[model samples]
Target: MKQKIAVLGPGSWGTALAQVLVENGHETILWGKNPAQVKEINEQHTNHHYLPDLILPTELKATISLEEAIKDADALLFVIPTKAIREVAHQVAAIVENQPYIIHASKGLEQISHKRISEVLAEEIPEDKRKEIIVLSGPSHAEEVAVHDITTITAASPELDAATYVQELFMNEYFRIYTNDDVIGVELGAALKNIIALGAGAMVGLGFGDNAKAAIMTRGLAEISRLGVALGANPLTFIGLSGVGDLIVTCTSVHSRNWRTGQLLGQGKKLEEILNNMGMIVEGVSTTKAALELSKQLGVEMPITEAIHSVLYEGKDIKIAAKDIMLRDGRIENEFS
Candidate 1:
C-alpha cells in the first residue's frame, strides 16, 4: 500500500514527515527550494540544513522542482512557512490539478490578509481543482519526530474521513494520531501557541522557573482559545493535542524555533539581527502580529499577546513588557472548557 506523497518545503517538519511516510511504506518526494537541501536529501539521505543527524529513507527522494514533486502525487503536504504558503501555492496551482489530498503542517496566519493557512490555500488553489484539506499539528517537535521517539499529533479536517485517513497514514508505534474536525481550532491553536512559546522562552531567558512558565502557558492558552472561539472554532479544541498539547511542547522544548528566537531576544539581541542569524523561519514573529491584529479586530482581551507584540514590534524592552504585565489589573481565571 504505497502511495505517492509530495511534500513541498523540505525544512525540518517536511523532512521528518517524509521520513515517517517512507518508513510507513509510502513513496514520499520532498521538495525543497534550496538546491543544497535537495541535493542533501537525494544524495546524502539527510537534509543537513535542517535535520542534520537523521538519515532519510531511500523511498524518500528530494527535488528542487515543484513540477517534479507534485506531478503524479497521491497526496500533497504543504510544509512551508506561513509567509510562503500563498506564493508557493501559486507555483503549484497548475500542477496541483491532480486533486491530491492536501495536508498543511504550517502554523501561522498570513501577516497581510490575516487569513489562516487553510483559507490562503482555498484562495490560491483553483476551486474546481480542490481536494480534501487536512491539517497535521500537535506537541510533536521535528527534532524528536525525526528520531524514533513517541509523539502524538492530531489530524484535523472538516471531513471526518479525511482526518481519519491522514491519521492512518502517519500513525505508527512511535507516532500516535488523533482525529479532530475542528480545523480552525487546530490551525488557530497551532499558529498562536508559537507566540506563547516566545513568552515562555522569555521567562526562561529571564531566569523565571517552572511556576512562572506554567502560568504563562496557561494564560497564553486562554488567549488562544478566546480568539479561536471568536472566529467560529470549537472552544474545547484548546484543551486537546493541537491546543494545550502544542503549547506545552513549544513552550518547554529547546527544539522550538519560536522559543529559541525569543530566548535570544530576551538575552538582548535585536529582532533584525536574530532573524538575519537564524536564516530560517521563526514563525512566532509573524504569528504575534497576526494574533495582535486578530485581537484588535475581534475585541478580545489578550494582554499576553499584546505584551509580546509590544516587545517584538514596538521596540519596547522585554523587561519593561514583563513589568507592565506584572502590574496589569488581574481577576479570577475562568475555564473556557
Candidate 2:
C-alpha cells in the first residue's frame, strides 16, 4: 500500500523494524532523540551503537525532529522502553494531526498503574487522533531481525482488522506476522516473559543446569497465565507465540538484555553497575517490581516473581532467593484454582 510510517525511538528494535518497513516499500522514517545516531543512520545506513555491525537499508530514513517524522505519516510505531512510552505518547498526542494507527512494539506494564502499554497509549492519545492501538510482540530479537533471520511475531488488537492490517504490513519471506485478538494476553505474555528470562539467566550464572532453567520457565508460565487470567486475559494465549514462545527465546537467547542483566547479577555484579554498563534497558528489572505489586494487590501467589523481586529490590542474595523458591510448599502442577 506504500503507507508512510514513523517509527519512534532509534534503538535496536526500532531500527530493525524501520529496516523491515522500508524494505517493504513503505516510506519509513526513524526518529531518535540523539542527533549523532540519526546522522549515522542517514549518512552511513548503520546504527552501530545499537545494532552494531549491521547495515541498515539505504532507503530507511532517520530524523531528530518528531514533528518532521510524523507529519503526514499514516501510522506511528513506538519501540521505546516501557518507562518512556507514556512520555513519548504524550508528546505525539500533542502534535499528531492525522488519525494514524497507533502501534507499539514495546513490552512491559506501567510500574505505577500496572497497566498495559496499550492502556497507557489509550490514556494519552486522544480518541479523535488515533485508531485502536495494536501491539506487535512475540519471540523476536532485534539483532536477528536486522539481519533477515527467520522470525515470527504476533500483532494483537481487539479489532481484528487492525491486527490483520499490521500482519500484512510487516509480513515478508523471512519475517512472518500472525494476528491474535487477545491484546491482554499478548501484552502480558510479552511483558512477563522477560522476568522469567532474567531468572533463567540467573540460573546459569548461579551454576545451575538446563533442569533449573526448564523449571523456572515452566513455572514462570504458570505464574504469568495466573495473573493474566485474573486480569481478564484468555488463558489459551499464554501458550501461543507471545507466551511460551517469547519465554523460550528471551530466556535462552544471548541477545536478551534482561537475561544478560540477570546473568551479571548471578555473577555477583550489582544492579546499578550492571545497568550502567549494559547501555540498554533491561525491562525485567522494572517489570519485576510491577509484577510483585500486582501479585500482592490481586492475591496472586507468584512465588518466582516474588523471589526475583526480593533479589532485585529487597537486597536478598540471589542464592538465598533461589533456595527460597525451591523450598516453597509444593502443590499439584496444573491446579489453577
Candidate 3:
C-alpha cells in the first residue's frame, strides 16, 4: 500500500531517504528551509551540494512550507541535525493535529542536555499529535544509498508494531530494514560511534598505520559500550549493526563526514576551518562534547572520547592525546563481562 510520507530537512540524508521512499512508491514530500534548494529539488531534481552527480527521482517532490509538507502525511521522517531537532519538532507539533509516526535518521546527542534525538523529539512533540517515535540507523551512508548501493539498517521503536510498520515502509532488495526494540542501545550506538570515527580519521590523517586504526576501533567500541550500558542500554546492542557495524563503517569509510572532519583535524586544521571547508555538519564534534559530559555524569570512563574532545575543543595536541591514550595504565577489558 502506498502512503504519504513527509521527509523533513532536505539535506543529504534527507534527500537520499526521500529518494528511497520514492522508489518504494510512496508519495514523498521533502521539506527544506531554503526555498532555492527546494526549487532546485523540484525543478532540477538534483541536490548537487549534497549528492553530486546523482539524479534524484523526478517524482520525488519538495516544498519549503511546513504546512504543505506535512499535510495529510501518514508518517514524518526527521533528518535534520541534532541542534535543530527540537525546533523542528516544536514546529511540527504546532502544525500537526493528527497522530503521525515520527521517525528520525540524524545521529547525534543534544549538546546541552546530552539527550538522544528520539528523546529530543519526545520532549517537543506532544503525545496526542505524535505516534511512536522510531530511529533508523546503521552502517548505511547517504551517498551510497542514493545510488542504489545495497545497504542494511535497523529501525527501532519500543512499539513493535511501529518498528514493523517502518520495516515494511522501507524494506526492498537494495535497502534492507531490521526491526529492534532496544531504542536506547540503537540510538546510543548511532551517536557514540561518531566519536570513534573521528579518532579513526585522525589516525589516518596522522599517518598512523592500519594497526593503530584497528586498536582505536576496538577500544572505542569498548568505551562506547561501557557508557551505553551505564545509561541502561543493552550491552549486546553495541555488537549489533547500530553499534559495531556503524562504528566500522564510519571509522573506516571515506564517505563519513565525521571521519573526514577528523582527518582535517589530524592534518592540524582548526574545527571552524574544517567545518567551513566541508560545508556540512560533522556530527562527531558535537557528539564528543555530549559523550564527554555523559561519561563524567555516568562515571563511565571513555578515554577515546575524552581524547577526541580535548583535541576538538580544548586545544590539546593530537599526538599528545594519542600518547596519553597509549600510556594509560593497562586494565582488563570489562565490556565482555
**Highest lDDT, which number?**
2
Q: In angstroms, how far off is 33's CA in candidate 1?
A: 1.8
Q: List the residue pairs that clash in candidate 2.
A: none
Q: Write the per-residue lDDT of candidate 2 for residues 212-294, one digit (tens) a residue.
A: 99999999999999999999999999999999999999999889999998898999989999999999999999999998899
Model 1 TM-score?
0.97
lDDT per model vs. reference: 0.89, 0.93, 0.92
In candidate 3 the C-alpha lDDT for residue 244 amounts to: 95
Question: How well does candidate 3 match the true structure in TM-score terms?
Answer: 0.98
- Using Cα atoms with residue i matched to residue i, what is each candidate's TM-score against the true structure? 0.97, 0.99, 0.98
- Candidate 1 wrongly placed segments (more than 4 Å): 335-337
Report residue 185 deviation for candidate 3 (angstroms).
0.5
Q: List ranges where model 3 is wrong by over 4 Å.
A: 335-337
Which candidate do you rate higher for lDDT, 1 or 3? Answer: 3
Q: 228, model 1: CA deviation in Å?
A: 0.6
Q: Write the per-residue lDDT of candidate 1 for residues 97-165, one digit (tens) a residue.
A: 578888999999998689999998888887577678899999888889888789999999999999998
Better of 1 and 2 by TM-score: 2
lDDT for each residue of candidate 3 in 134-245, tens digit (9 for 90 to 100):
9999998899999899999999999989999999999989999999999999999999999999999999999998999999999999988888888888888899999999
